[model samples]
Target: MAGESTGKKKKTGMKSFIGGTILTDERISRQFPFVVMLAMFGLALIMNRNWSEKTIRQIGDMQKELEALRSEHATISARLMDASRPSEVAKKVNEAGIGLKEPVKPPRKLVVEDN
Candidate 1:
């Protein structure tokens, strides 16, 4: 019995794995499609997370820019209102020495008869 057992060759688990013979097993082949599908799902999940983070960053940047623009607009509007006052206009005109003056008299109204 010892001689017969020694004469027969048996493949060990470690030997078959290291020798790359385990990939040819029927069980591994049957599960190959399921393994590939799982890998694809993992890749898609990672991509989705990356995209969501990028969009959030972009929205934050846009909000900052909008705030800056709003402040600028308010400053410009205030400056325009101050510069358009009658006193401010007259002062600028006098500084330029254009020799133009406000009317001193209240003029009489003219009435014409329609034919």
Candidate 2:
């Protein structure tokens, strides 16, 4: 009789688990908080990984934009340097018919003697 009862208990244990009644068991109910905590930790890990990938993608895009901007800056700086040359300035002034002329004489400084 005792052996038959023990066998029946084991079968009921498996049946309870398969039928979802295991969640209502006293032992499992006691540890429900721990199970929930583990679930939260798993969710947090997934979220962290997703956020890290997003940040990395953004950084890559920013780096590409930075390189483009740097190239543009270099091109503009070269153009500015070319435009600021004395010959270029004189040519532009002549093209504009502004009638401004470069002085041929060297600049002279005047000195005043105070008594």
Candidate 3:
């Protein structure tokens, strides 16, 4: 009777191979593939979020650069407009001692006859 009981115990001790452990359960091994897949999906989502944030930050930096360039252009354009006025040009020309004078008399055009 003891021999029969020992034989039954030995038969029960023969555990089936469960991956990554010495357990006899087949359920965890069957679900391992799905668990790894879910973890990979979660990692991909995190990476995508990080990449999008980086892109958004780059766009913001470019927008700031564009605004600075526009301000510089406006400043240069205003300076050019002020310098191009006739009064400003006359003053600068006189300051430079160029001796330029404004015309005072209305000139007549000569009439030529064509035969």
Best by lDDT: 2
**What does candidate 3's lDDT look like per residue over 21-94, in tens digits?**
43344655677789899999999999999999999999999999999999999999999999999899999999
Steric overlap count per candidate: 0, 0, 0
Candidate 3, pairs of clashing residues = none
Which lDDT tens digits does candidate 2 get at residues 66-96?
Answer: 9999999999999999999989999999999
Instruction: Estimate, for each residue in 1-115, the C-alpha lDDT of model 1 and write its tens digit.
Output: 4546655454548888899887787767799999999999999999999999999999999999999999999999999999999889888999999997766797889999999
Worst 10 residues of 1 by lDDT: 3-12
Angstrom error at residue 73, model 3: 1.9
Query: What TM-scores do the predictions have?
Result: 0.71, 0.78, 0.63
Question: What's the CA error at residue 109 for candidate 3, in Å?
Answer: 9.1
| Predictions in order: lDDT | 0.89, 0.90, 0.81
Q: What local lDDT score does residue 51 receive in model 3, on the 0 to 100 scale?
A: 100
Go through the candidates in order and give the C-alpha RMSD of each one to the true structure: 6.5, 4.0, 7.7
